[model samples]
Target: MKFLIFILGPSLLAIAVPLYNRIEPRLAGFPVFYWYLLLLIPFGSLCLYLYDRGRSDDRRPE
Candidate 1:
């Protein structure tokens, strides 16, 4: 369902990043842990923004 997707999507991304680091040690200029850790802030914010936007868009005019 949409609700499940919205909640789980970000969590999956969070988990995958670390898994990716384990598979590929270097990303850009940093180690996988550092890269994933740095990405957490922006990725989390983006997920929250998308969740809010989806909720707003789902509203129907009354």
Candidate 2:
């Protein structure tokens, strides 16, 4: 479950360049690549947060 969260960013980013390299779709006049990267910001943050949450739970107290 947690492992899936960690891979979210990598998986999406792996295809992001090819997927959003075009300029066919525009959002608010912004290019698809621009908005696509903007959208990934929050998504990547969420993935990192989830991974950190899961990693912290595995810590061993000294």
Candidate 3:
């Protein structure tokens, strides 16, 4: 359902953070752990924004 998108964003982070909990790979001297978390901010926001956008039409008055 539409609600899945709302749940998916944070759920992905919850699952991904631990799975990706490593310091091997680096980006611009930042460890994978640090950069990946930084990257997720926008990704998570986009997911939630998409979810809200998907629901906006439903709430609009005719």
Candidate 4:
């Protein structure tokens, strides 16, 4: 699960650069590259929250 976090967050963002490095199909008159980066903000936050939640669970006395 921890490994999945890295793959989803950073890896996904990295993948987007090449995949969305285009100018067609713009959103709100913004290029795909720009919109992708904007959307990544929330996606990255969710990933970080998931990671932090998992990490906290690990530290709890069991």
Q: Against the true structure, whose TM-score is highest?
A: 3
* Candidate 4 regions with alpha-carbon error over 4 angstroms: 60-62
Give the per-residue lDDT digits (tens) of candidate 1, residues 1-62.
66666677767877775465653577776877777768776877777777879889778887
lDDT of 3: 0.77
Clashing pairs in 1: none
- How much is 14 displaced in model 4, in angstroms? 3.2
Candidate 2 structure quality by residue, lDDT tens digits, 1-62 = 66765766557684768888978689999898888888887788788887878778778886
Global local distance difference test of model 2: 0.77
TM-score of 4: 0.68
- Please report how far candidate 4 places residue 2 from its true position, in Å: 2.1
Score every model by TM-score.
Answer: 0.55, 0.68, 0.72, 0.68
Judging by TM-score, tell me the better candidate of 2 and 3.
3
As a whole number from 0 to 100, the lDDT of residue 56 in candidate 2 is: 86
